[model samples]
Target: HEPVPTEWTRTTCPYCGVGCKLEVGVAGDRIVATRPVIDAPSNKGHLCVKGRYAHGYVDAADRITVPKVRHDGRWRSTDWAEAITLAADGLRRVAAEHGPDAIGVLGSSRATNEENYLTQKFARVVIGTNNVDCCARVCHTPSAAALKHMLGTGVATNSFDDIEQAKTLLVVGANPLENHPVVGARIRQQAQRGAHLIVIDPRRTGLARIADVHLAPRPGTNVPLLNSLAHVLFAEDLVDRDFLAARVEGVEGLAAFMAPWTPERATQLSGVPADAIRRAARLYALERPAMALHGLGLTEHLQGTQGVMALIDLALLTGNLGRAGSGINPLRGQNNVQGAAVMGCDPGTLTGSVRLVDACQRFEAAWGVALPHKPGLNAVTMIDAAHAGKLKALYVIGYDIFASLANADVTAMALSKLDLVIVQDMFLNETANSFGHVFLPVVSSFEKDGTFMNSERRIQRVRRAVAPRGDSLSDAEVLCRLAGELGFGDQFRHTCAEAVWDEIRAVWPAVAGISYGRSSRHGLQWPCVDEYDPGTAVLHARRFANADKAKLEQVDYRPTTECTSEQYPFLLTTGRTLHHFNVGTMTGRTRQQLLRPTDTLDMHPYDAGQLDLRDDMPVRVESRHGEVVLPLRVSDAVAPGQLFATFHDPARMLNRLTGPVRDTVTSAPEYKVVAVRVRLA
Candidate 1:
């Protein structure tokens, strides 16, 4: 048996974006136990199964301890010296053969702000290219882009604590109970306390079942549904005229745009009844202090950015901005997803989400290098470029593009053509196993000292709970060594994560005041610009009154390419469950796998009955892109013509069936709506 833990370290949970504070028990170099922190602000004394049991994955059997280099098409473990040298040489050779624009770098949400910030800098300064993007491109990039464009910042206007004070809550495209348990628990508890709850989804989610008003719109019709809701607010005179007169502009333009959308018309397009739309609108409008929370359901669609803006428009229409119990908030999927974008890991942005070209001179002065001025390709576009032989090299940092990308079969073909593929992660993921030329093993979050920004935009400390498993290093350490090998080590001089954070603080205005010295038992929310600023909880308080009044843009809904036909009758949607995280990389190795060891495709009982399909029957689900066979789950949770599934189990390869239909503005994939045909094999 393990010896009794003599020491304990406080850190944030590294699973979902709920950011539950945890205390990990340690004896010497081993972590023995973990429990929720009683006074933690986000998830006080509450933990889901993942937070409770997912720590055992750090010592997983397949963890890569040393770096490996592919020689003669075979793998051979090598020392750090040869590994870094080999990677540097390959990158140089690629850059020499095909210019800087031919290289692309992909960052991961699993990494820290310091690591991601440095990764982008390495791409811009060392490689002399802006071809860097993060996992958010496939996840919440729509939220960030739409929110930033509509509002001043690309984050939640209010804090999570607002859920308690809200008299009415609007949850869209999210089943918090399954995906984010702590937040779900609180939202569910609010309903039990007699708060009016409204849930909007195609299928009846757990919260939707208990909600006072549940609006089920057809998949891919979020625009019509939301526009119809706004139309009701306008037609019934439920909008807050005083708030609009004082703080908003472009009303006439929006009025003209929304004039054609009536609840009846929305019913025709979205398959939802007019009565339900009006009822949900009144319940949300009449209720004082109404708050909204949404997840990937609002995103991961072709009109994702517009849909987000529509959701924000409702809050704005009701005067919900800058209030305690009422505002728009996004529910994130991964722990550091917000941080990846905040750190400016995208091709077009620099630290703090500023346009790279606008900040080029400033960065060049600081780092002593002429930064890349032109914007480069995003994640999806990078893959397309690689497939077309335009991109020659790719750097994947802790992300499994082969498993996460839409039409992953095409991704495999694209990566095979790369001259060099460098992968950095704890394990050899699908992308690494298939096309990796150099592999650098990295330590887990439990063995690294850094920080993660939660869904609520709170920055918290992540202390090292245990020593690294073997010769594995933190991502920051690996990047620093690689920069030294490639020349211009002075520009990337960071001995530790804290040192990297210092540079981040100097560049990113939102996080300038968040020093490691600050007490982190309760993490600090951003827009903490100076040393003495206490940090902002709710934004746009007085600013909407003065020159910084919110601008109301006229946005219209557009349809995606995924249209159901006689050949492909059923619509497919994707999401996660309570027991696992994305791609099942970490949780699969832990005891959590026992809870859910495989994947299943959920079809409504009525749909299954038509084909003589029973529960747990194997079926082949084929889409326009690819196909996968999964056990059928005859569930009433989905609608008659809609199906649902989770891609947590990678072997299922559900993404293979999803094509590259993405949002126009942010390029977020339309994972929520697809046409597929199912049959018994």
Candidate 2:
């Protein structure tokens, strides 16, 4: 057994979106143990299994801490200088020969805000391309797009603290218990305090266990169910006239638009009981103050954006926004997803609500250089373009684009077609395998000093716990060195992340209020002006950012083109398991974590019973695109005709079986509901 530590370092948990502040115990140079900070708002004196015991991954045996280069179809250990020159030369040569449009950059949501900002900036300014995106593109791009369309911003309007005061909590398509345990615990606490909990999902999830009303509707049926709830609320005269008139706009069109969605019609389409729908509507409407929390499950379908609009309609119909304990909240999957989006990870975006073209014009006037106006392809489309011989080089930072993208085989083939691929990551990831030219070893979160913005938009510090392991360097350091080598050192020179942040604040208006100094204490939330000016806890409180006003869109129900059939009799949904994070590169390094890993499929008892299978039975699950054989876990939490799988294990190859259908608005793949078939192996 390990000996007790003498001192503990106060830091944040490296897992989950909860962003719990952790106090890690260190003995000499190694981490011994970790505990929760007693005063952190996200987690007060509590820690999860992963957060408490997963520190070993930092000093794991299999970590590739040194820089390596792939030359002549083989990898060779290389020094920092050779690696940097090779990466810069390869990327520049590709851009010089094949036009800037031929290249794309993939940012990371798990990275610090400063790192995300610089990565996107490198793609846009240095590489002279608008082909920049992040992991949020796959998980919550629809949420950001839909929220911006309706609420005038791309972030959650409510904080986790609001749960304590909410009278009703409506969770749609999010299993916080397993995915976001701290948030789930808070919801449970609220449930124990008599706050009505309503869950809308295709499966009976962990959250469903504590929900007062769990509507296990069929997959892709969110639009109908949400619309019907709005119908019931409006028909019953539960609409708050005062709240609607004072706080919301376009109240007239909302009533006429939702008239077609009756409870009976919704029941016929969605499989939830008409009475249950009515009861849920009544409970949500009658409850004085309620909040709506959604996750990827709502935004990873064919009609994802439309479903988000329907949920907004329900919130507006019941006057559940723009006040204490009431707002539209999306529980982001990644740690810094909101910050990444806000800091301009999207190709057509800029900090402070500026579009690429418009912001470039403004930035050109400031920096004395014209920025590129042509918008580039998104992550998924970029791969397709590459496969079709339209795109050439790709510079990926922090993200493992291969496994994260839907249809791994298709993406891998696309990568193979690229003339040059530059992967800058802490490990030799699945995406890094496609690097034809160079690979740069970058510092992991533990070896770096930076700032990460939590889901609440709170900008917090990530102090360097240790020196750069092996020959690895921070992403910022690598980018700065590359910029210097390319004769752009004058522009990229910075002592630390703060100096880079100051440049961003000077140019980007949305980030104008935030500063490193202000963020030092208790982590100030964004839209923060000064030390005295308290940061905004909730957004769009008085009026939307749009100069005119909010106009509620008239949304109608439309089913996904792909549906369950005789050959593909089940709907496949993908998500994170309690034991692991996305792609399982970081968390997979731990021996204990691997022992309790998410290398299996979770299915309902009825589905397994019908297939003549028992718990832990090996089964081959297949879809049109691909298939995998995994150990079955028959759980009552999920419903029959639906299967849940996790992409945490590379061995599982779950993404191989899911494909191609993407949101037209965001280019995010519909990973939540895909038609598939399962059989005993």
Candidate 3:
């Protein structure tokens, strides 16, 4: 007999927003190997360790293969029809008694654009509520709100491919090497190609090690540092007057707002040298085609929106917009979070960046239902409402509230008080195990056919590699069946993912040109307006979306809500590790778990010496809200008065120590800065 060849299927990585193209080798329903796609535009044949090896989670023993319902405080496996009936009836009963606004739906960042589209549709049309949101509420909501307000778009202005064309790259508050490895590789490659790399972070990350200028400012002082840089651009006369005159607004007021933030004053507050600030400013200004990138470090603060706006001020000050290598970029943390927001999973906006008032009319004409015009509760407010007994029902898709939220105990209490808690995911996570009333088993991305919009706003196809595991269903199928059972069958009668996608294309003008057939050969960046049009690579080249000019805002530095005190003498920050993904829902089940089995509290050697703490010694880290005990690792990466830890290990539960304070503009929790006290266990 001749040897048989394994079948290969192309799909996008399910890990981060880099959207690395992957090739999976399947043999008799089992994934045998994984490789990178050589021709993919974003990743260009490079994959992170999680993207290459995390497929083991698909066949894990704990994979949920059947739907379950709780009876007498116990779970019992059931068929799809009974589960759908129970779920639909539970939600309908809550809506009838408490009003539709009492029911909130949390769409998943890990889900497909089609699935998220149906998620918001089912919430608005079938249930007649605007209480729909995604995980972006906790992550990139500020980036979306601030970027859209200033630059007229909520996404990256230039493609990842444009990084190679830059002369200077300013990276702020993001550790991309550990979080977005593919993009990190590109940044390193650009650095080797003689681009001036300026890293602004409290801790020295991998990129910071090789950066020409590393400004290790104090935590939560990004606004002042960025303002000082802009002041230098003004003081040194390095600003692009022509670009400001042609394509920008509000420049006259910026100088007055930034007057107080001289290089010396900023150095006094931020701990970075004044000369270093001037050097970074000149490099970013004189170096033509300079680009800037930022992450949660800039967004997870009390002044997060202001921090983003300040970075945008720098880009616009140097004429860095509407070009090949220049623009502001945000490294989104999740795979499909951009897609989820663009598909109208947010309470504030409808699909394609349409406001709620306009979306009501457009969606009503398209879906044949009257949509809610009032704004709904966000993630943090929804928990508060549930605790107050105002929110009766919650339908969560692929999110573990207890594990990911700021206060684990409080989130658990709110979920426990809900009349109906429906959780749809691949596993029985902390949320499902504690409070889920009905559990709908959902398949992994490997077994689904859909599209994921990446960090660059590129819509890529995720082809089905194998049949769904056992009785597990795609999220689209579950939503379609649930909508049908809720008497919206005529509107949501789609039988395939492509049918749902076609409806999305027809409704959202930004993605009007995108189709399964068009993106099959390769991915397409959004704003592809027509069927014959090729997707856009750079945004705002000739003009902004709403106006002909981009808007500049005057922002000021604001101190964090929580500051270091005598009782809590240290500041703690949270981030991700290269080996583990967020909350470790899927990566924990794979071989990656063996690479990093537990979480550790990272501290500076000076702080460890002051407390007589040694490496691998157990210690208790306590904040005003909560505490966690973990083994300590003393490293020079952190400042003396600061501490660091990852949220991958559930045992440590780092979010418990974070406060409930959120950004004023977007309700994103301030996870980066928390006052804490460290003691030996």
Instruction: Please provide, for model 2 over 309-426, each residue's C-alpha lDDT reduced to its tens digit, 9 standing for 90 to 100.
Output: 8888788778787777888888887777777777777888876547776677887675555678877787878888899998898888878888888988888888989988888877
lDDT per prediction?
0.88, 0.80, 0.91
Q: Tell me, by lDDT, which candidate is best.
A: 3
What's each prediction's TM-score? 0.98, 0.97, 0.98
lDDT of 1 by residue, 637-678 (tens): 999999998898888988998888999898888999989999
In angstroms, how far off is 420's CA in candidate 3? 1.0
Residue ranges of candidate 2 with Cα displaced over 4 Å = 434-436
Candidate 1 lands at a TM-score of 0.98
* Residue 463 C-alpha lDDT in model 2: 66
lDDT ranking of the models: 3, 1, 2
The regions of model 3 sitting more than 4 angstroms off are 1-5
Full-model lDDT, candidate 2: 0.80
Q: What residue pairs clash in candidate 2, if any at all?
A: 204-637
Q: How accurate is candidate 3 locally (lDDT)?
A: 0.91
Which 10-residue window in model 1 sums to the lowest lDDT? 544-553
Please report the TM-score between candidate 2 and the true structure.
0.97
